[model samples]
Structure formats: structure tokens, C-alpha cells
Target: MEIRQLRHFVAVVTEGSFTAAARAELIVQSALSTSVRNLERELGAELFDRTGRRVVLTEAGRALLPQARQLLAGAEAARQAVAQVSGLGAGRLAIGTIQTLTCVDLAGELAAFHREFPAVQVSVREAPVEELIDGLRAGELDLAFLAPDARRLPDGLAPFATWQEDLVLVTAPGHPLAAAGRTLIRDLAAEPFIDFKAGTGLETAVRRLAAHCGLERRITCDVTQIGLLVDLVRAGIGVAIVPRRIGEAAGLPCVRIRQPEPGRSIVLAGRAPRPRNPAAGALLDQLDRLDRFDRLDQLDRLD
Candidate 1:
């Protein structure tokens, strides 16, 4: 049957009477009644058994009710998908991220996004992984870049993309373990350590590593900024665990953890739902383009 006819059919079932459905649909009662009648005629079954004032659904009507609703819902979703991709009007994107984003250059991507979609207001919040997850669940943030704790994520949060990276122990030039080819966690039990504040991704992962090795880390210093944490390590405040790429880039001694080698997943996560924010969708599209360009550059190098 026609979509309009199905819409009218659902309205009548909802209001329980032709008069009420007509008022609800903002049409004349006769028109609503005619639409339902036409639908019934096409199906070759009497839908509603009209008893005095209240309308009751017949067998045919009961079966059709669910399918009719499904069709209508599908139609609405299609319409929204089309509208979102057609254009981006004025909007805003509230984004959250972790302190260490070594895998992807979010700053550079956001800068490019700003130049292209200047009308879209974008705000970034840097927080620990736990806080970022809470923000997404509470609807305070639209999307987040996180070093997720392994592959598990909250039920409603889904990753848009994931990149793997190694976590290495960083120490200054003069530290005793700095020159070790590969060290074990038990070897550092007595040494002072520099670690990120609790609730952070790196700290949590490092703590898990310590627990696995059955040793408590002597965290003599706690820092919020990754750069500051690295600097402290450079100055011999204490040894710290950091991303391999970041530690190497900082010119620090990055020793591999031979036992229980820890790795991290850098993921771009968003809430699982239909009709995502148009601005967020635009950002994803932009990232896709940039990723394609990066792949092309890699291929050129190979050539």
C-alpha cells in the first residue's frame, strides 16, 4: 500500500477512533477514514472492526501493524541519511581526546577540517581515558580519540578506526637500566618511577603491567602532561613508560619490556546510534580523504 495510507492506518490504530486520528493527523475525519478504507481494499481484508465508538484491530490489522510501523521507520531513516549528506548547515562538534596522540595527528587533521568547514564550530577537550568514556556516555562529547584499554569498550561506544602502537620503558642516559637491551618489569620494582596521573590510559596500562608482574611500581612522580612526563624522565626524575615512537622522538633511551610486552590501541570512538551529528560525519569524511592521501604517499615511497 502507499506510505501515506500506512501512516493513516497507524494513526487510526493509535487514536482508537476515526475522529481522534483525523484531529491528530490535522486532516478532515472523512479523509483519514478514506485512506484507511483504501488500504483495506488493496489488502482485501477488513482491518478494523468498528464497534460503536472504540475501533478494534482484526486479524489482518494486527499482522499489518508491525510491518507498517517498520516500513515507516525505514522511510524516515532514509530521509535523514540523504539530508545529512546533502549539505552541512551551521553546527558544532564537541570532541574529546587523550593526552598522548602519537598514532594520528589529530591537531593537523582538525586544522585542515577548520579550513574546509569554517562554519562548523569545533571544540576539543583533553582528558584521561576514563573521563572521556564518561563524557561520551553522558552525551557531553560527540567523538573521542582514546587509547582504549585493550579491545573492550563500553557497550554503546564503537570505534571508527583503530591503530596499534608499542609501549616502551623510557629512561634517561645515566639511569642504570637505560642501557639494558630489554628489561623485565620485576627489575624496576625498586627503582623510582614517573607515571601519569591515575585514570589515564597510559597509567592504567602500566599499572596493569605491574600487577601482572606481581610488583608495585614506586611512582615517585605523577604528571598530567605527556610532554612534562617525558621531560621529567629526561631529567632523571624517574623512568616512565611511553609510546615507542614518542620516546624515540624525544631522544630518550626506550628499552623494550621483554616480558609481558604492552601495546596500546589508539581508537577514534563514537556513540553507537543512527543519525550522527553532521559535523562529526564531515570530520570522518575528511579523515578518510587524508588517510587515502597518506596511503598514496606510502606507495610513492615504495615505487
Candidate 2:
């Protein structure tokens, strides 16, 4: 009838005597006897035949034995399921990212996390920064890699890490800006630009930098794909401001921005209160470890 009583009954049957089961269970013999008797009473059936010196199971006892064992096994399995999630052995993690994030190797980092926590399911979604932030705030995403304005991060979001990266001007070969070794922000004001589509962090950065220079960006073409933007620049469609790493990789002529150079702070952000995903927490821990090791190595190089 009760789990404790079933456990006591099973122990008595296994030990072949009430005295031995009581000893095995670390309980008084009378208490063990009372538990078995209560179970039998609740079930309205006799569980044991006590006529002989060696007690044996009655028909009802044999019928209940397997079911009792199953119940105990089920209880144990439930506990183990909870333990797995609590220990970060298994769960799901939904992570979001912007289109441009060259500062960290996101794929490599995810692969490392998968190796360490093979049971954790990882899902990655790539979108513009604004949409990623919206997903984070809506609880649809557990973590996000973004370029958040340091002066105005969203209300309930917190940054886990931040790094600075310069944005360079990429133009077609022999373009005036590319021919010049250095150019100011205002210098590009009148030039036609190939820029990221609206709602992108890069687009916002371009606008901010232009506003700082007291100029308006003359956007000739807007694109959502980085590769297409680079191709457009290569084809002489228009010059564009992009992350320095991207420009270098595209082999486009890159000109340095001078006098309030364009740049952005890349951030790994999550909801401020933190979600209750053990897998997400584990991934974050792995990232922190790698970041700390990198910083320590940098310090060592200075020595």
C-alpha cells in the first residue's frame, strides 16, 4: 500500500526471515513486522505463509513482488532524470547570434561545448541584432552574441563579455578612399555607400558614426548578406563600412577610418535575471574558462 511497506516486504522476502530483514533495514524486528502486516492489511490479502520455520510467499505475495520492484525502480529513475538535468548532463540550449561576429569563433566554441556536454542539445539561430535582442527578451533565446550599444543596452539584458573591434572602409580597387591611406568619417559622407539593411547593429553603428561626424550617410545599396555586400564593393557598386576582419578576408581594399574611427563593442548578452537552463549555464561556464585562459595568456606575453 505504501512504498516504505513495500520496501520492507521485499527486504523480508529477499532475506528469507523477518529478523534478517529488520537487521538489513536497520530497524527493529517489531517495526519491520508491523510494516509488512500493515501492507497486507491495506491490500486485504495475506502476503506470507508463516506456518513453517522458514516463511514463504503466499500467492498474493508473489503477484505483488514484481509490481513493487517496478515501482521502486520507477522512483529511482525519476530521481536520476532530475539529477541529470541539475548536473548539466542533459538538456537543451537555444542560442542566438547576429550576422557579423568575427571576434569569436562561434562554431568552434559550440563544437567544444558539444564535446564536453554531449547530452546537451545545442540550437543556434542567426539574425540581425535587433531581432536577436527581441528573442532574448521574449525568452525564446537563452543567450545571444551581439553588438550592443554600451550607452543603451536593453532594459532586462546583461552583457557577459565585451570586446572592441574596428570597422574599416572597404572600397573597389583604385577608389579614392582606398587610394588614400587614411580618411576621416566626414570624408565618406558624400560618397555612395553599400550598407547593411535596417535593424542591423552594423547599420546602426554606421549611422551613429556619421551623426558624430555631423554628416549623413549616402546609402546607395542595402544588403543583409555580408558576402553580397563584399561582392558589391568588389564590383564597384559602392563602398561600404564593414568589420576589418571581414574586409581583409574578402580581399577588398580597406582604408582606415581616422578622427573618431568607427568601431563597435561586441557583447555576449543574456537576460538579466538569467534563465533556468543548466545546459546554457554549462556552455557559459566553458566560454568563461576559455576567455580567462586567453586573458592569462595575454598577460604572460607581456611578461
Candidate 3:
């Protein structure tokens, strides 16, 4: 089957509908359908069960999914390999990270990378570490900056640069907790808490810390954005648990956690065999030069 046909098929499967897939692929729905039809004809199998409201893979489609993804990823990798020989004049880079990423000036890094490699199309997504892991394993992401709650990273990924961060509680000015010096985790049980949604690194850490301290927190709000979370704290809605660096950057009162401190690991990682986009490597090398990371090579740490 043609690579374009396979791409259309895969897009439809991932997006869950031909309409959405066509929109994502920037092609007419009819054209995308025609391509998938041709692919199915060549394979002599019905790839999708079109009877449902949300399109789903049929048995044959399920069988082809992994191999199809691998083939597509390999093809893209080869194309990028060739493009980089011309100094990254073409090809795309897809990087993912969590909203809590504070170790690097991500926006500034992207802007600089854009100026240096003008022709390369770049996209960055802020998502939960779990979804980022899925993207990495599926080869949809070139690289990711993740704060994994778990110590051991999932398979099919390799760690590069990593930063270990301490967790601290941030409070509004004049809040009772602000002047407490270092607060114990158990002391936060009665306080109003602002937290991120479930599955995020920050939210997960807060949950784990609370659990370890054998106390249930009084959560007042579950926010999705870091800026808004900090703003809520600034408005005295509640306090939040975040990495020490982010808490400090918020310009609010940051209190350390004592009696078994809370912490998480921030790591730059990619697909284990290596990433497809050469731009990912270039960006990592630039980050290395910036002296922001504890070299993975030196520590030989993964996860």
C-alpha cells in the first residue's frame, strides 16, 4: 500500500473518525476515505467497523495497528535522517511535556531552535506524563520532558538529561502557613489545598505525600493550568504543592516540607532506540550546553 494511504488509515484510527482524521491530516474527507478504501482493498480486509458512532478497529485492523505504526515511524525516521544531512532543512519535531515543567525556559528554547533551524516545523504539547509515555512508545513524540512519579520509567524509552527537584508548599502572602518556616506534611491536613487534576505529576506527588503522611487533604480546587494554580494561591484560595523551583519562581511564600520531604524526578527522555527527529538530538545538545542538566552519561541514571 502507498505510504499516504497508510497514513490516512492510521490517522482515522487514532482520531476515531474519518472527519476528524481528514481535518487533522489537512485533506478532504472524501480523499482520506478513498485512500483508506484503497489500502483496505489491497489488504483484502475491512480495517474499521464503520457501523458505530465512533469508528473502531475491526479484527484485521487491530492486527495491523502495531506493524503499521512501526512502518510509518521507520519511514518518517528515514526521511528525517535524510533531511538532517541538509542541516535540518525539512521534517517535523514533536515534543511533549507536563504543564509543571520548570527546569528549562521551554518557550525560549523553542524560539531559539526555530531561529536556528528555520525550515523545520516544530510542535510542543503539554500533557500528563502517562499520555506522553504513550506518545513516545508509539513513536508519535520525538522527545518529552516528564516528571515521572514512579522511579522506574516505562519500557521502550531511554532517559537523557535529568533533574531532581524538591517539593514545597506555596502559600499566599500573610497566609498562616507562610510564616511557619518549614511545615510538616501532617500539618497541611486541615488546610485548604489547590491541586492539579488527576494523573499529572504534581497532582500525583501531592496525593502520594498526603497518603504517606496518613492524612487526607482539604482540597478546595482542582486546577488544570500552572499559572492559574499559582494565581489561585495568590488570591488566597488555597495552597499548592509544587517543585521548589516553580514555587520559588511564583514569587510567593514557598515553605519546605519536613518529616519525610516530598519530591519528584524530572527527566528528558525519548524512544529507547533513539528518536526519529534529528532536531530532538540537536535540542537536547543545546540544553546540555546551557548547563541545566546533570548529565545522564555521568550519572548513568535511567527512569
Best lDDT among the predictions, by candidate number: 3
Q: Which pairs clash inside model 1?
A: none
Best by TM-score: 3
Report the lDDT tens digits of candidate 2 across residue range 1-303: 787898799788756899988986789999999999999999999999999999799999999988887785455345445746567565667799888888888899999988988877677778888878876765557789887644556778766666677999999988877778679887776788998978787888887888888978777889999899999999998989889999999988889999887888777777775544566667777878876323211211222
- How far residue 155's Cα lies from its native spot in candidate 3, in Å, is 3.7
Candidate 1 has a TM-score of: 0.65
Question: What are the per-residue Cα lDDT tens digits for candidate 3 across 1-303?
Answer: 888888888888766799989987889999999999989999999999988787989999999888889999989988898988988988888899998887778899989888988888886767898989988889888899987867767777778878777889999999987888688887877899998989998888778878888979898999888889989999999988988887788898999899887887788889765565788888887777888787665224653
C-alpha RMSD in Å of predicted model 3 compared with the true structure: 3.3
Residue 157 of model 2 has an lDDT of 77
Residue pairs with backbone overlap in model 2: none
Clashes of 3: 0
Each candidate: what lDDT? 0.78, 0.79, 0.85
The weakest ten consecutive residues by lDDT in model 2 span: 294-303
TM-score winner, 2 or 3: 3
| Per-structure clash totals for the candidates | 0, 0, 0
Question: Tens digits of per-residue lDDT for model 1 on 128-195?
Answer: 89878976775546789887765567778776766767999999886777766589888888878998
